[model samples]
Target: MIDLGALAKITKAFKVIDNDKSTNRLSHAYLIVCQDAENLEGYMRYFAKQLLCSESVPCESCRHCSLINSNAHQDVFFYPTSEKGILTEDINAIISESYVRPIESEKKVFVLSNAQTMNAVTQNKLLKTLEEPPKNVYILIGTTSEQAILPTVKSRVKKVEISPFSKTVLINALIDQCKDREKLENAVACSDGTLGKTLALYQDQNLKNVIDLGIEILTKMQSSKDVLEYSTKIIKNKTDLDQFFDVLDMLLRDTLVKECGDQSLITNPNALNQLQNANFKNGALISIISAVTDARKRKQFNANQNMLIEWLLFKILEEKFRWQKL
Candidate 1:
C-alpha cells in the first residue's frame, strides 16, 4: 500500500476514512473535488492502494500491491476523458463496472477522474448507480468543482475539498519542467495554485511559448500597432486561447493593483513601472475586464477568433485613446 505521507490534508482525510473502515462504517461513495486536478490523482491512488491492501497499511510488496502497482487489479477501475475528455461512454462503463464482482481483492474501487465533465444525462445515469452501490465496493468521483456535479449526485456522496497548492510548492514542482525564465514566471502566475498546470506548461513547450507571447502582449501596451500585433498571437492558438485570456486578465489585474498602489501583491514586479504608467482609471479597468470576460465567453460558442481579436483590441484602444484624449 502506498503511504500518503507527503500531503498533510490528504493524510488527515485518510485518517477519517481509515477510522470509518476500522469501525466497519465505510461510506459507499466519495466525491473529491479541487481546483488542482493534478493533486487529486496522487490522493486517489493512495486511497485506492489503502482500500485494496490486505494489511492496515498497504504493504507495497504484497501480491495485491503488485497488481495495483502493475495496474492488473481486476477490481480497481479508472475512467477519465480520452483525447476529448470525459464522455458519455466513460460514464456508462463505470456504471457497468460497478456491478462486476471483485476478481481477487476483498473490495472494488472505481476512480472517476474529471467527474465534472459529465453532462446532465450521464450524471443522471451515474446517480442511479450511486443510489444502489454494489456490496464491498467504493466509488471515488474526482472533480475540479463540486458545482459541476449535479446537486442530487453531490448530495449522495461525501465531499472532500482539495485546495490548490501554494506558489512556492508550485514553483518547486515546476523546477524540473521549466527551462526558460519567462515561461517559469508566466506558468507560476497563470497556474493559479495548480501544480498540474505548471508542470503541463513545462512539458508542453508550445503552451509556454503562448504564455510568453501573452505576457508580451499585456506588458507591452505601448503603441496601437504593438497591441494589434500581440493580440494576434494570443488569438492564433485555439487550444491555449482560454489560458491566454487568463494570463491577460492577470496582467491587467496586476496593472490595476499597481495603479492603486498595492505593490505587495504584484506578480510581475519587474514590469510594475510600465504597468503603472499604462494604468487606467477604475472605470476603464472594469470595462476592459468585462470585455475580456465577454471575449472568453465568445470563445466557448465557436466565436470567430480573428474578429474576436479585432473586437477586443478595438475596445481597449477606444477606451485608452478616449482616456488620453480627455
Candidate 2:
C-alpha cells in the first residue's frame, strides 16, 4: 500500500515505487531527499515497508510490516549508525553486513540517513556496493540536500525528492500530536512545513526565550547598546542555530504581516500591537524578510553557522533602522 503518511507531498515518488511494484521492477537504489533528517528517516521506514510487504500491497497486520515499521527488521541496516555521523569504521561494517542475505523478508535494505556524512572513503566503499548489489539487495540513501553528496555517489541512485507540506497539511498532521491549541498554533505559525521541525520547535522549552529575544531586538531598536548586548547574549552560547533563525524569521514574518494590516494572517497574534508599532515600514520589513530567506538558503550550503546568524541579526537591525528614514 502507498505510505500516505510520509509521501503526501511527494506523491510522485510513491507512484514510482507503486508502479515498480506492480511490474516487479523496483530500482535497486533510491535516494530520498528532504530537509529534515528525522522526517527523512521516517520516509526510509515507509519505503522499507513498501519494499518488504508480502501482499500485493503492504498489509499493516503482517509480521514483516510490523518489523519494518518499528525498524526492527533483521535485514535492514541504518547507516551512520550513530549520532557521530558516518566514519570509515562504520563503512567497513556496512560493507561487511551487505553480504548477508535477508533472513526474514524477500529483500534486504540498507538505509543511510544524513547520507552526506559519508566522507570520500566511506562513499567509495558504498560505491562498490551500488555498482554491483547482490540479489534482493536495496540501498536507500536519505539526505537533506543532494548537493552535499558527491555527484558520483548521487549518479547511481534514482532520486526521490520530498518537499515540506503546506501550512494546512502541517497543522492537520500536528493536531493529533499536540493537545494545547495555542501552542499548536504557535508551532504551526513558526514551522517551515516540516513535521520534524514543527514538533521540535513546539516542544522546545527555550522557544519562548528565542522569540522574546527577537522581539526584544525590535523593541530596543532606539538604543544601539541594548541591541548589541542582546545580540551578544544570544550568540555567545551554543545553540540550535537553525531553530534560532527560524524563531527570528517567524517574528519578522509576523511583523511583516502586521505591516500589511492583515490581522488574520498574523502568526504571533499576541504581539500584533507591538509588531505594528515596530520601527519598520512595509518595504523595510519586506527587505529584511528577503534577507532572512537568503540567509536560510545559505545555511543549507553549510555556511559558518555563528557568522551567518550573527550577520543576519545585524542585517535585520540595519534594515529596521534604515527603513525609518523611508
In terms of lDDT, the best-performing candidate is: 2
lDDT per prediction? 0.70, 0.74
lDDT of 1 by residue, 81-104 (tens): 475556778768877777788888
**CA RMSD of all predictions:** 5.2, 5.0
Model 1, residue 189: what's the lDDT?
Answer: 67
Candidate 1 — which pairs collide?
Answer: 1-58, 1-59, 1-60, 81-85, 81-86
Q: What would the TM-score be for candidate 1 when compared with the true structure?
A: 0.68
User: Candidate 2: where are CA atoms >4 Å away?
Assistant: 1-12, 54-58, 70-75, 80-105, 216-220, 223-244, 257-274, 290-325
The 10-residue segment with the lowest total lDDT in model 2: 1-10
How does model 2 score by TM-score? 0.73
* lDDT of each residue in 66-184, candidate 2, tens digit only: 88777688988877777888777876776777788779977888888888787787888888888888888888888887887878878898888677766666667777668876677
Model 2 residue-pair collision total: 1
